[model samples]
Target: MAGIGPAPILFNEFFQMFMRCMPPNGWPVNSKIAVGNSGGPDSTCLLFLLQKLLTDLRSKTMARQSIPTSVVSLSVNHNLQEASHSMAARSAANAAAMGIEHLTLDIPWGTPPFSDKPVASQSMEQVAREARYHVIFDGMARTGAHSVAFGHHADDQVETSLMRLARGTTELGAGGMRRCRRWGMGTGDVEGGLGWVGHHGLDRWIIRPLLDVRKDRILATCEEHQLDYVNDPTNFQPEITLRNAIRQMLTLQEEGKDMVLSLLIITQSALSGLPQHISGSLEKIKVAAADLQETTMDLEGGLHQLHGAVKVLSSRLEDVDNEVTFHLKNLTLPSPPSTLILSSHALPAIVDPTVRLALVLRVMRYVSFHPWGSLRADGNRRRTSIQRIIDTLWQSDGAPPFTAGGGVLWQPAIFSAKKRLRVGTQCLGRRLQLGERFAWMASRLPAVPYNMLDTAILPSKLDIDVTERLASATSRGDDFLEVLFDCRFLVRFDLSQIPEELVEALRKSQETGVNVRIKPHTKYYWPKVVLRKPSCVDIAYATLMDNGQIDTFGHAPWVTMKYIRLLDAT
Candidate 1:
C-alpha cells in the first residue's frame, strides 16, 4: 500500500472512503459537518475533499429535494509556537477562499497544565492533541455539527501502529487508528469537568475518511486543485515529536526502505480488519445460544433465579423428589441497572487470545465508570491482567469477585446444586462445566467521588433553577440540570419538578440566613438501591435547608437517567 505512492484522490474513491467511515447511523440530510482544518496539506485537502463529496451527493440527490448539507472548517490554535496564530489565520483564509465557514479556538495558554513551566516536554505533543480534539468537539457541538472529520492519512496510520508496537500494545492497538470511532478519552486522561463543553457525555463521533489515502496523494490532490497549504516547521524536526521521528525514519534513504514501508502498511491493513471480523463472529455465537439461556442470559440474574428456585424446592419434601411436577410462583431475580453479563459458552470454539481479549474489552467498555481507566493502552501488561481474569473464568470452581479496568467489578456466577440433569428445577451447583455454562457479571464499581458536585451553597428555593452550566441543548430551555455520573450514566435532575413543600422550605431557609448545602443521598445509592427491569438507576439528592430540616428526593419521574457508551473498545 505504501509503494502505491502519491496520486490525486479521485472523487469516486474519496466518496467511497468517506462513506465507509460514516457512523452506523448515516449522516442525516441537511446536517453540518465540522472539519479539523489546521492549514496543513492533509487537513486543507480533507476540507476540500469533504466539501466536494457532500457537494456531489447533493447535486445528485439532495439538490433535487432542496435539502441543504453544510461543512465548516474548525481550527484549534494551541499557541505552542510563534506561528500558531498565523497558522490559524492562514487556515481561516484558505477556508474563506474555498467559500467555507471557518472558526478558530485559541487555547488558554495561561491555564494550569499549559502555564506550568517548561510546557514543551515529551508529553507536550500528546497534550496539544488532546486539547485540540477537546476544542474541536466543543466547537462541533456548539455549531450544530453531528460529527467532526479529521485528516489523518495512511502514513499517519502506519506511524501510529508502529508507535503502538514500540510501546508493546495489544493486537488491537497494533492495528492503528480506527477509521471511525466515538470521540473519547484524552490520550491518557478521562474527560471530566464542569463548564467544559467537550465532555458532554453523549455519543458523538470522529471520522477519519482519509485513513486509506497516503499523505503524498493528499498533497497531490491539493496541488491538482491549486489549494494552498503550509508545512509546520516543527513537523520536519524529528527531535520535536515522535510522529516526526517516525516519518523521518520511514523517509530515510535506505536500500530496503520501500520494501519495509510496504510491508508495514500491509501488516497494519490486515491487523485493522481483524477486530471487526472477530466481533462479528462473537455476535453470531451470542445469537445462536440465545435460546439456551446458557450464554445470552444475564449471569447473576440467572444464577440468582436458579438458586432461589432450588431453595424453594428444597423446602418442599414432595417437590424435592419430583422437581418437574411443580412450578414456583413469585420467584424472581433482577440484575443491576449498570451491569453487563457475559457467558463462557458464548465464546467461540477456538482459543484465540485476541478474540477473548476483544470480548473482555467489550464488556469492560459497557460497564466501566471512567473512560480514562480502560485497559486498551496498558500494552502487554494489560494482556496479562485480562488473561488472569480469563484464566480464572476457565477454572472449575470459578473465580472470586474481582475488579477490572474502567472501574468494573467482575463477579463469577456462584450456584449451589445437589444434583443435575433436570429441566427448570435442578439445584444449582457450584463449579459448573468450565467454558461451558459458566457466567461472569460486570457492573459499575460503586461510589465515584462526588467532587464534581457543587456543594458551595444551596439555592433559596429548591426549584428547577440549578446551575445552568450542566444544561444540555437538548433541554431546550427547560429548567434542568444534567450531569454525567461516573461517566457511565447520564443523570439529569429537573429542578422545575421539585416539590412545593421543599421549595417553600428552601425559600424560608434563604430568608433566615440558614447555611444550606445539597448533597448526595449516600444511603440510597448503589448496593442499597434495588435495580429491576428496564435497566436504569436512581440517583438521590438531599437538600440541607437548615440545621434540622432536610429534604430528600429521588430521581424517579422528573429526572431522566440512562446509560451512554462513552468508550467503544475499538
Candidate 2:
C-alpha cells in the first residue's frame, strides 16, 4: 500500500473534532436538528459540516435503523443593514445547495434599541442579538426542532471572559458559555405563557459544536470548501463596538504570544479548583441550614444561615444598594451565633447581633412563614400569586414589609379573620350551590385551570372584587374556592344535598359577615391577606390601597392567599 498525501484524503477535520466531543450518550439520534446560519464564515462552515455529518452518520449507523433524522437551517436577518436580507438569502441558498431544509427569519430593528451604543451612530449589536435569538427560537418551535446549534468559536470565548472581567461580574461569567446548559426563560417571564410554552426542556436541546475551534480554522475550512459567504459592513465599524475592539485586542495578543493557548490555560486554571471549593463548602454547612424557597437569607448573631441548595436571585443593585440578596427560606442555624456580616466586598463571617443584624437584613428578610414546602408540594401555585403581588408593590413604589423577632409584618389594611373565612366559605358554597354561575365565571377567566372551583378558596366580597379585577386586567381565568375549615370545629353538611337557592342565600349572609368583619378596621395601609393553594401551603403578601378605597396597587396575578393576619403594632 502506497502512502497517500493529506491533500487527497477527503477528511473533514472539523467534523471529526466535533464528533469526538459528543457525550457517551451520543447526539440525539431521533431529534429534528436546527442550525443557526448567519451567512458568515463560522456559521456557514457549521451548516455544511453538520449536514454532511448527519448524512454520513445516517448511512453508517446500523443501530439507528429505526431512528429518523430531519435537519433545518435557520438564518437570522438582524436588519442592521440593507445587506441583511441578502445575507439571509445567501444563507438560505447555501442550505438549499447542500440539499437541506432552510428558513429565513427577519427581526425588525428595535426602537431606541436596548444597547449601550446609540442606534443611528453605531452598531446595535446587543439588541440585534436578543432579537435574533427570539426569532430563532420561534422558528425552532414552528418546525418541531429539538435542538438549535450555533457556531461560537474559541476566540469568542476569550472575548466574553474579558468583557465580564471589565464589568466586575461574578467568576461564573468568566466561565464564558457552557458547552450545554438550559436556557433561561428570562426571569419571571418564564412563568408566563411566553415561557417555554411549546418547548420541551430535557428532550429539546441547544448545542455549540464549534466552541473549541478557532475562528481562523472555521474561515480556513470555508475557504478550502470554496463556500461563498456574505460580509456585514458594520463589523468593520471599529469605533462603535466592543467586539471590534476585542477582535483587535485578540489580534494584538496573537501577535504578542500564543493567545489561544494562554486563554485555555487561564480559563482552565480559574475553573479547575471550583468544584473542590463547592464540595468543601457543602460539607461544612449543616444540611438543613440553607433555605431554597424564599430567595431570602437570614442571620442572627454569629450564626450563619447557608442554603444547601443555591439560589441565584438578582435585583437592581440600586434597589438593594448594589448588593445581591438571597431569600433564605427555611434556613436554620448551622453553628453557634457569632457576629459576622456578608457584604458585597468581604467574605461571610460569624459575629455578634449588633454587627450581624444589618448584614442579615441586607441579605435575607426573615418572614414568619416558610412557604417553600407547601409551594413545592402544590406546584408553586401560591408562589405565582405572591410574585404577582410583589410585582404590583414594585410598580406602585410601595415599601416592602418590615420584620422583627416574631415575624415580618406589612403596614397594610387589616381585614378581620372572620370576614376572610366567611368569604372563603361563600366562594366554596357557590360551586356547591350555583353550578351554572360557577361555570360561567370560570369560562370568563383566562388562565384559570379546569376544576378550579374544586380546589380554590372563596374570598370575601372585597377579596372577590380584587380577584375579579386581576382576572379582567390580565385576562386570567377565574379562581376556585376551597375553604380550610377550622380543624378544631368540623361542621358536617352534605354539599350534594344543599339546594342551589339555599346555597345562594347562605352565601349572601356570609358576604354580610365578611363585610362587617372588614369594615371596622381602617387604620392599616393595606390588607393582610393569606393565600392558600394546593400548590402553596401558606404564603402572605400585602395588598396596598389608597384612602379612597380604590385598588391603588399591590395585587398579584400569580399567588393565592393562604391566610391574612392583623398586627397590633401600636
Candidate 3:
C-alpha cells in the first residue's frame, strides 16, 4: 500500500492485488521479503514493481529513521537447459540495474532428477518444480526471509486446476493453487527430509500476488517498462509436457476466446472460494474439539504457544461436523498431548464423507511426528491407508495398536470400571452413561522397534546433527540455535551452557580441524558441544537416559522444547 499512490494505472491494480493476497497481519515493518525471479515475463514484471515499491517506501520514511524492510530477488538456475546460466545472470544483472540485491541458486547438474538424462518424461515438470522450490527456500534461509513471493498468475491457476481435474482430485484440489500457503514445497513424505533449521520460529509463507491477474496484463506491464525477459523453450513444446499441451490448446484457439475467458471467470468466481470454506470448517472442528484457553502459554526468548494441558470437550453435531465427544476419566484433562484420545460415537452422523476424511487427516497431521507440510505424498495408496484407519476407528471392536502414515500410532483408550463410573458421575453435563466404549488414542510412534518392520522404517536416531547440510546458510556468531525438530517441536539449544572442558576441546578442534567428539554420555546430564564448519548448529541430547528411568529434570536444562503451530497446509 505504501507504493500504490502516484503509480501508473496498471501498477495500481497490481499493488491492490498484492495487498489483498498478503497474510492477515501483513508483513512486519522491519521484515525482509524475497521474490523468486526466473527472468521470465511474469517474474520480470514483479521485480520491476517491487523495485518501485521499495523506492517509494524509502522516500516516505524520514531520512534519520532506519527502514530495515528490504526486497531481494532470488534467481534459481536449474542447469537442465542450455540457457539456464545465462538467464540467471541476466536476471541478476537486471535486478542490480534496478538497485535491488540479488542471489543466484544454481542446482547441480548431476542431481537426482538430472541423474538420468533430461529426457521427455511425464513427471519432469514436477521434478523441476520441486527442485526450484528447494533452491528458492535455500536462498530464503540464507537471506533470513520468512516469506517468498512467486509470479504464478491466473492463467497458471487455470492450467493447474484443469490438470488436476483431468487426473482426479478432491474438491480442494479442484479449486487450484492458494494465493498464500505454508512454505512446504520441498518437504516430502519423510519427516525432516529437508533438515531445515529455523533461525526464526515463525512458519514460512509463500505469496503469489499475481494469482488474480491475467497473463496478458503481466506481459503488457513488461512491455510497457521495456523489460527484457527470457522464455523457456520447453514451455512452448507441447509434446514435452501436459501443461504445455494444455497451454498450446488454449492459446491456439481463436474461436473460443470468450469461452476461455468465461471459464477463467467462472473458476475465479466459484472455485477460488472453496479453500476458505474448507479452512473455516477445519478451524471450527479443531476449536470445538479441543479446549486450550487456559493452557496456552507464551514463553520468553522466541519460544511461543506452549500448551500445558488440553481438554477434549463435547459439541453438538452439525451437517458436516464430527460427533465424537471425548471425556477423560475423573474430569482431568490430558497433559500436553503426547497421546490424543478421540471417541468413536456419532461418526456416522456426519453426513459428508469429505468432511469426515478431512477431519481425520487434520487430526493425523497434528498428532503425527510429521507436520501437515511434511506429508507431501497424497497418492491414492496413502489416502487408502488413512481411510482404513478411519474405518478401524469407526468400528467398536477393539483392535491392537496400529500405525498410520506420518508416524502416528493409534490404539483404543482403555479405562477401568471405577474410572468410567467416575466419568459418568462427574461429567453428567455431557450426557454420557457408564461403561461406554472410547475409541482411538493417537500418539507419536516411537523410534524404537515394536516390530522388525518398525526397525527398518523408523528413524534410527532423532538427535543427529544435520548442521553440515545447512552450514552455508546458518549464522556463525550465534551462541544458540533453534531447531524445528520432527516438524512438531521447536527445540532450542544453548551452546554456551556446555561444560568448560567440552568448550575448550571444541575451541581447539575449531582451529586444528580435527574431528573430536565426546563419548556418548550414559546419563542425561552432560551438555555436548559440536563444532561444525562456519557456525555451531545445535543438537542437544535430551534423552540420554532410556524411557521409564528416573532422571533429574534440572540437569542439562539448557535445552527447551515448545509446540509450534503447524496448521498451515500448502
Candidate 2's TM-score reads 0.45
To one decimal, what is the Cα RMSD in angstroms of model 1 from the true structure? 15.4
**Cα RMSD, each candidate:** 15.4, 18.8, 13.3
Model 1: lDDT of residue 104 = 93
How many residue pairs collide in each prediction? 5, 53, 0
TM-score of each: 0.69, 0.45, 0.65
Q: Please give the range of 10 consecutive residues that has the lowest summed lDDT in model 2.
A: 438-447
| For model 3, the run of ten residues with the poorest summed lDDT | 307-316
Off by over 4 Å in 1: 1-5, 62-68, 112-118, 185-201, 253-334, 348-350, 372-381, 414-437, 447-477, 506-556, 566-570
Q: Candidate 3: where are CA atoms >4 Å away?
A: 1-9, 57-68, 111-117, 188-202, 254-339, 343-350, 376-381, 390-404, 414-439, 446-458, 463-478, 481-487, 499-552
lDDT of 1 by residue, 38-122 (tens): 8999999999988887777776853423322889999988877788888999899999998898889877755743443236456
Q: List the residue pairs that clash in candidate 3.
A: none
The better-scoring model by TM-score among 1 and 3 is: 1
Q: For residue 250, what is the lDDT in candidate 3? A: 48
User: 310 in model 2: Cα distance from truth in Å?
Assistant: 25
Ranking by lDDT: 1, 3, 2
